[model samples]
Target: MVKIKISSLSFNYDSIQALKNVSVEFREGEMVGIIGPNGAGKTTLLKCIAKLLKPHKGVIYLNGRELWSISNKELAKILAHSLFEVPKGFNLTVLDFLLTSRYPYSKGLWETEEDLAVVEEALTMVNAKHLVERKMEELSDGELQRIIMAKLIAHQAKILLVDEPTVHLDLKYQLEVLSILRRISKTKNILTVMTMHDLRLASIFSDKLVLLHEGKIIAIGKPQDVLTEENIAKTYGVKVKILKHPKAGLIVIPLSTL
Candidate 1:
């Protein structure tokens, strides 16, 4: 099985430090959510793993090999990141956008039948085939979100790094998107690490949770273990009541600000 092992990872933006000696491990078929307040280095952590941002001091191993030693082209084959924001005024169709996900595998300037097949398969996997011909400017928020998720799946990477897969959507769409991501992690046996702002949703969907506070990991383990009342209080500065829902699993209700 594919695995990610990070040790002593540190990153900085000149004077400002983003991550501080953060170490964590993730495994295949597990959906891990990184939850913290703003400026907690959630996105920075993903960027470092994707090699979009270089870590100042750290060692990241992907499937037993050093990540920095891996070529960018080879890394693209194993890792895919989805920063799911609806692009405005982009004159592109869903099919056109999804096809771009095959750039790493494309040999020619044009797409092959295999590429088209993969695109179609990805759309189907995300239940977005009806949106294939729709323009990017014309999709509803939920539809556009689905298209973005399809684009990520089209990459066919083993590690899926999603930055806030559910954002600016209604309750229905949020659950829908999260459910799709959770299902894909198991079905594809890919390691999914997403940064989520919703603590309740993170607690319910994630097999493991990495709770970050001020660029450092305060807790990392199973959702039940990491999302304790004390952890929430200490990190978020909020007094919360964690409820065990009969249907929805863990429910973290913020009772008051500390």
Candidate 2:
């Protein structure tokens, strides 16, 4: 079934248009990745779906009902999201951070045993149970990434809207984080939609790809269909050679002078 449906969406930042007539639908259990160049409205698209930014003209439906009809608390239960870090001042532990996810269900009261159990499972799911008491600020980049992911799992939402899950991580952590997300989506049967700047990584891990250009969806399909030479060249303004990798199946190589 279609869990998200966006139709005729448009958004602007004052005079700057961000999204234009964009429409897409996400079915249940889909692991989708959004890819685009710097100003392709990729982040805006995610924000719109996450209800952070309201479009001037469009309809966003969640499970067939208009998205705006759902209250924030209810939406929090249905959709769990995480973006690149913003300003921070919290001193929550890894477990504390993860347990916060249960607030939508518990309303800031003392957590029940069920909440603690879910938090424990979430910690183990991300392989961070050992760091349950670790201070969030003391973690390495990769460790912090996993902690955030564990927190999301604690949320227990069926749909995850994540932005740049591998931001500011080294190559090893990048692969590690993406691999964990891939595994979680499969094992938990949740639909995940994340935005990534690395098209190669996105193509490798994503079950579906949404290619955006100039605030519109230029292509949307399987990685093989959306990551074509022609489409990449037009959307990214780069000369790319698309070939089947001996091991990676499909890979893109840029052949342009910087």
User: Which candidate comes out best when scored by TM-score?
Assistant: 1
Per-residue CA lDDT of model 2 for 1-258, tens digit only, reads 448999999999899999999999897778999999999998899999988998899999999999888899889888888864523567657776777789988955699999999998888877888999887778888898888788788898888888888889999889888888888888878889999988778888899999999899999999999999899889888898988776575778999823
Over all chains combined, what TM-score does candidate 1 have?
0.95
lDDT of 1 by residue, 126-195 (tens): 7889999988889888998888888888898999999888888899999989988888888889899999
Q: List clashing residue pairs in candidate 1.
A: none
Question: Which segments of candidate 2 are over 4 A away from where they belong?
Answer: 84-90
Q: What are the lDDT figures for the candidates, one per model?
A: 0.90, 0.86
The CA lDDT at 229 in model 1 is: 94
Q: What is the model-wide C-alpha lDDT for candidate 1?
A: 0.90
Estimated TM-score per prediction?
0.95, 0.93
Each candidate's number of clashing pairs is 0, 0
Q: Which candidate is the best by lDDT?
A: 1
